[model samples]
Target: MPPEFVLPNYVLRVFTLFEQFSDRLALVRGERKSTYGELIADVLRIAAGLRDAGIRPGGKVLIMAANCFDAPALQLALHLHGCRALWSAPITSRREIDQFASLADADAFVYDQTTELGRELAQSLAPMTVRTMAELFTDGSPYEISATPVPDSVLQTSGTTGDPKLVHHTQAFYEQILELAGAFVANGFPLLRHYSSSPLWLASGQITSFFNLFTGGVLFLTDTWSPEEFYRVVSTERITSTYVTPPMLYELLDHPSGEDVDCSSLFMLNVGAGPATPARLRQGIARFGPVLRIVYGLSEAVVVTAQPGLTEDSAHPERLASAGTAYGDVRLEIRDDDGKVLEPGQTGEVWVQSNLTFAGYLGKPELTAETLVDGWLRTRDLGYLDADGYLFLVDRVHDMIVTTRRNWAIFCRPIEDVLASHPAVRTAAVIGVPDPVVGEAVHAFVVTRSPVPEADLQQLVTNTLNEMWTPAAIDFVPELPLTRIAKVDKVALRNLYRELHPDQTGHDDAASRAGEAR
Candidate 1:
C-alpha cells in the first residue's frame, strides 16, 4: 500500500515569509490594500485574542461573516492554531445556524453584529462562546500556535433539496495549498490579481481568499456580486483571474457592461458551480477573450476536472460542452446503477477518487456511506467520457425528467442547451412537474431579452430535438431563481410551478389556450 498521506509542516512556514515580502501587496478590497506584513500581523493579533478567549486545538469555531479581508485572516488564524473553523454564509438563517451549531459541536459562535435572529441562535447555542469580531479582536499578549493533524475546515453543501450537509476537510486538504502554491511558482504565477464576490462562508469564497494568499497573490474581495462593480474592477484593477458560478456568468455576459468593459487583462475566468451552456461558453470567449476556463467540482471533492482554456477556434469547439479532462491526482470513472463501471461514450454517474475528497458529511454516517464508497466519491452527477477522456456532463440524476406521454426519458440539460441557443432567450431552466395524462410533464422557465411568442421557443426546440424533447408549457420570467451557490434552483422553480399551476394538469391544453389568447 502507498504511504499514508501527511500534511507538510512547512504549511505554516510560508506565512512567516512576511519578513521577506513585507512590502508586497497581498490583499486588496476597494481602495484599501494590505501588505504581506500587515496581513500576517492582523492574523496573529486576532489569533492571539482567540487563544486568550479559550479557543484551543481540536476546538471547532463557527464564523458567520460577510466578505471582507478580516475573514480570511480569522480562518488562517484558526487553522494555524489547530482549531477547526466552520464558516457559514452570513445570509444563512438562524434556524440554519442552529443546525450548523449542532453538527459542528461548536465551541464558539462568531458574528460581526447582533440581530433578533442572531440573538435567538446565540441563546439556543448556550454554553457556546458567542462573541462579535470586535470583542474577539481585543488587544492581548502575543501568542504562537502550531498546526496539528486534525481536520482544519468544515464546508456546508448548497442544500438544494434538504438540510445542508456538513463537509469536513482534513489537513490533507490544506497540504494541497503548498502543492498549488508550488505550481504557481513554477508557472510564474498565472493568476496574480484575483477577484471574488463569494461570501466568506461558501467554498467559492474560500478559493480566492486562501489559495490566492497562499501563492503570494493579491485578492480583490467583495461583499456581493454586482456586474457593474465586477466590470469596473476587472477593467480598472487589471484583474488577471476570477471565479463565477453559471448564473453569475450569465448575468455578466448579459450585462451591458460586458460589451464596453476593458476585460482584456483577464487571463483566467474560471466558471463552475453548475453546468454552463455551449452558447454561453462561446459568448464568454468572445467577450473575455479566450480566458473562459470551465471548472467542474463539488463541495465534497475540491477539484475534479477543468477545461484549461477554451476558445471558439480551439481544437474541439464541440468539446466546449464537455467538462475537460481530469488533472492533479484525480481519477474519474462513469458507473451505472449497480456500481458497475461503464465504457467510454456511455452516460452514467460520475465517480471520482482523489486525495482531496472530503473526510465525509459531519454527523451523518449513513449519508456519508452512501456518497463515499470504497474510497470513491459518488458525485451523483450523470455524465460520460469520450475516447480522449473528456468528461461530458448530462444532468444531475435527480434532475432527469421522465415523460410518460411517449414513455421516454428527457434530460433537462440538452433541452436547456437548445433553449439557450435561441437568440431571444437569455437563460433557461427545465424541470418536470406532475401531470395526470403523462406521469411527469416537462416544464420550462426562461428569461428573454425581448418578448418572443411561446410558439417560437417551442418551435426552436422542436427543430433541434424530437417531439418528446419539447416542453409541455413555457413560462417566461424576468429571471430564474438561483441557490446560494448560484446554480439555477430547479427545486425552487418546481415550487413556483406548483404555485402557478395549482391543479398541475392539462399542460398541453394550457399552452394551446394561452396561444389562442395571445
Candidate 2:
C-alpha cells in the first residue's frame, strides 16, 4: 500500500460502530447471515489480499458483481485500501460492460466468480490482474489503518436515456452519506432493515447500502425481484425499509396476495427511479398505510427531494403528484432556457447544488461541464415547485414532444398521468415518434387491468389537457419495457414504435417543421 494512502475518519468511525455491534446481524443474502464482526473481518482480509496482490493505493479497480453477501465488504475493503473502485452491473449487456471496462482504464478487475458474466469478463480481460470474492476473503493479516489519501468511486449511470456513463464520486460523497445517515438516526427515523435488488453499480444502490450499514442496520441484498418475493421477505424478515421504482410498486399493489401480506413492520417504502402516478400512490397509501416515501433524484445527485409518509392531504390532494421538498442541504432552483431562476408555479429545468453532487463524469469533461454548470447540476428534468415548495415533474427535457398544432410543446408526464387516472389503466408511458403532420407526435404505451377503447383514453388526455396534447396513437400492451434499473425504457418504446410503423423513416425534418409552424 502507498504510504500516503489511508482510510478516512468517517470510514474508521463506521468500522468502529461495526466492532461495537460485533455480534449483531449486518448483512443477509439468501440463507446467508453475516454479523458486523464477520463483515469487518472480511473487509480487513480483503484489504490485506489487495495489498498482497500488488494492487496499490489509487489503483483503478473495475468490479462486476451482483448483489451478494460479500459485496458490501468488498466495497469497503477497496475504500480502505485507498483504491478507486469502478462498479459495473452484471445485468447490463457484455458489450456495454466491455465499453465500460475500456472507459474506466482500470488496472485490475474484481468479480464474483459465481456469476457467468464475472467468469466471462475475467477470461476476456486476460493478462489483467483479476481477483474473485473467495480469493479476496481468504485468511490473511488484517490491513493497518492510517489517515491521508482519500478513496473514490466510479458508478455507472442508470442508462435510461442511452449509453451509461461513468459517474465519478470522491471521498466527499461518502462523507455526505455518513452525515445523512447520522441525521436520519438523529431525526428519529426507523433503523432500516433495507431489502433491495439495486446493484452497487448504481448510485441508488451505493447510498442504500452505505446508509444502512453506516447506521448499523441490516442490509438484505438480492439479485432477483418480484412482488411475491418482496411480500414474503417483508412478512418473514420484518424489513423496515426498502426501495422500489414506480412499476414495482404498481405490481405490489396489483398482486393478489398483497392484502394478506404482513407489511405492518415496514416503516419506510421508498418509491423512486421514476415518477409514480397519483392513482397508484393513492392505492399504495390505502394498502400499506403511510409508509410510502416518494423520492426524486439522479445519478449525478442522489436523494435530491423526498416526500416521506405520503398521504392524500385534503388541502393539497395534488401534492400526491409532487416529488416533495428539497432534502438535506440541497439548494434547488427551477431555471428557464435563459438560465434565469423561475418563480414557483413555472415549469422549467430543475437544477440543484448539494454536497451529494458527483465529482464529474469520468473521461467526459465536455458532458461534465455541460451537466455541472457553475456549482449547480442541471437535472435535465422539467418540473415546477408550488407555493408550498412541492416539486411536480413534467418530463425530461429531451422527452418534450414538439407538435405543429399551434407550434405547441407537450410533455409526457401530464399525458401519462391523465391516462393513469382512468379506472381501466394500470400504468402508462408516453414517447415521441416520427410524424409528418405533427413533427414529433405523442405515442403512448399503456398497461391495463381491463380492456378500454383507444378513443376513450385519447379523450381522457384531451379532456384533461387539450386535443393538442392527446397521443397520436395508443398501444395497449401487457407491460411497458423497463431498463435494467426498472425505469420505463423510452428509448426502447421509440424503437418499438418504429418497428410497428416501418413507413415512418426519420424525424430528420422535425426541427424544420417545428420552426416553420412557429
Candidate 3:
C-alpha cells in the first residue's frame, strides 16, 4: 500500500502499535527485559506519577537518564501530556545539564542515576521537583495529565543552527517519522538484540528505541560502548538492527571480536549522527554486507533523508561523501545569501523543511526566529547538491577557516576522503592558524598508518588540494578532542591551539590575522 499524503495528529504516534501487542518483548537492558504490556503499564504508571507531582500540560520535564525502557516510556508520558523532555545521562556533564536545565526551565526533573551526587544536586535545585526512578514507578496516580492542541509550528530545534538551540515542529511531526519506521518494520524490521551501546540521552538512541517499541523489536543498551561486551550481547541475544556512529563502527571493525562474532543475523546497520567518509562507508558495506543504512538528520528534526542501500559510484567516486537522497516529507534546497536557489555544483547553505521539525527553542526567541525563518530552518552548513540531488556537506559555516591564501572551510572530511586515497595516513582534521605572511596556514592533525615524514603529508595535501589550500604542518595527535555531541569540537580546538601557541597569534580573518601574526 502507498503511504498517505497527510498524517493525522501528534498524539497518533510511533508507539501506538505497542498498545495492542501487549505480551511481546520490547526492551532489553543489562539483565532485564521489558515486555510490551510491562512497557505500557509503566508508561501509564509513570505518567500518572508525574501528573500527581504537579506535571501538567505545557510543562517541560527533564529526564536525566540513559536509553533504558523507562526512559522512552517517561518521554511518552511527557508527550502524552503535551509536555517536552530533555534526556539526561553521564555524557551530559553536570555543566551541560545545568545549562540545559536552566534553559528549559523545566517544572520537574527525573534523576535516573543511583549515585549520591545525582541525588544531592537534584535536591539542591530550587523551585523544581525531583523524582527518582523508583519514586516515578512506585507512585500511582502521579497527576492529572492533559492532551491539548499542539501547534503546527510548535517544534523544538535540535542543534542544527550552529548553536545548540531549540526550534519548533508541527503537530504532525512524529507521525511522519512513524511512516518511515512503520514501512521498515513492515518489510522485516529485525529485532535489535545487541543494541546495548547507543548514546543514551541523544536522538540516535531515542529514535532507535522508539522504532523498536513500535515495530515489536527488542532494544538493548549500555552506559558505554565496549567491543568485547557488544560481541557477547550480539552472539548471546542475536541483535539484528543496531545504530552505530562512524568512529564506533571503526572501533567494532577493528575489534578482535569483529571477525569472530557472527553477524549473519545483523540485518540493518544504521549509520548517522555524522557523515560517513566514502572509505569508511565502503568498508562498512563490504564487511556488513548491503545491510547498511545512512541517515541524515539533526536534533531539530527527525531524519531528513535515509538511503536503505548505499552504493559506490565510479564517475564522481564521491557519492559516499553524500548524506543520501531526501526522504519522507522532506524538502532539500541549497540557497545563497539572497535566498536564491544555487545551481548544481555551486555551494550554499542547506535548507530543509519537514513535518518532524520541532516546536521552537526553549528560552532564546531571537535565536529561534533567526533559524526558523518563514517555517524553514536554515542549517548553518555549507554544501552543494549533486546534479542527481544527492547532498554533499563541506563544513559547518561557523567551522570555516578564512585565510589570506585560501578562503575555504577547514573540513577534515574532504581531507579524510582524499587521505583515504593515500596509503599512509589513517584519519585527519585540518585546523587553521594565523601566519604573518601566508595569512592562514592549515595545520593537519593526523592519525597515521605508520611513521610518515611531514614532507610526505605536505606533498599529499598539495597533491589533493591546491598548494595555497595545502596544510602547512602535519601534527600527529594520539587522539583528537570531541564534544559531548561527539563531533570534533573545533571551537575547543581553536581555543586550545591559540592558548598553547600564543606566539602564533589569533585573528578572525586574513587582514586581522596578518596584523596579529606580524
User: Where is model 2 more than 4 Å wrong at Cα?
Assistant: 1-9, 158-162, 505-518
Cα distance off (Å), candidate 2, residue 52: 0.9
Q: How do the residues 1-518 of candidate 3 rate in per-residue lDDT, one tens digit apiece?
A: 12322233244453467766778887777778888878767777876777777776567666666545567677666666666666545454465556666666667777776545467558767568888866877555454434443422222223422233434444456566567667866777555554745543565565666666666777776666667876777777777777776666766766765877777777777887776667667777777788788888876766777877666667866777888788777888999988899998888888888876765676778877887878797877788888988888887665565665545445555765665555665556666677667555676677676888888777776787757656776667666566555566555556666666666664445543432332
TM-score against truth, every candidate: 0.91, 0.95, 0.87
Which regions in candidate 1 have their CA more than 4 angstroms from the true location? Answer: 1-11, 16-20, 114-120, 123-126, 146-151, 405-407, 505-518
Looking at candidate 1, the ten consecutive residues that score lowest on lDDT are: 1-10
lDDT of 2 at 462: 94
Residue-level error in angstroms, candidate 1, position 142: 2.1
lDDT of 1: 0.78
Error of 2 at 194 (Å): 1.3
TM-score-best of 1 and 3: 1
What is candidate 2's local distance difference test score? 0.87
The true-structure Cα RMSD of candidate 3 reads 4.8
How would you encode candidate 1's per-residue C-alpha lDDT over 1-518 as one tens digit per residue? 12332243333665765556778898887777899898878778887878888877667888777676677878777776767888765566656666777778888887766334555666677677887676767677886655454547888664554466788887777676557666766788564788988765676666556777777778888876789988988899999889998888888988875798888888889998888999888888888877898898887887789886787645666688888889677999999999999999999999999877888988999999999999999998999999999999988887777567657767888889999988888999998776657666778999998888888888889999977888989999889998766778777787688678767535565532322221
How many clashing residue pairs are found in candidate 2?
Answer: 0
For model 2 the TM-score comes to: 0.95
Candidate 3: where is the Cα deviation over 4 Å?
Answer: 1-16, 88-90, 115-117, 139-171, 187-196, 406-412, 506-518
CA lDDT of every candidate: 0.78, 0.87, 0.66
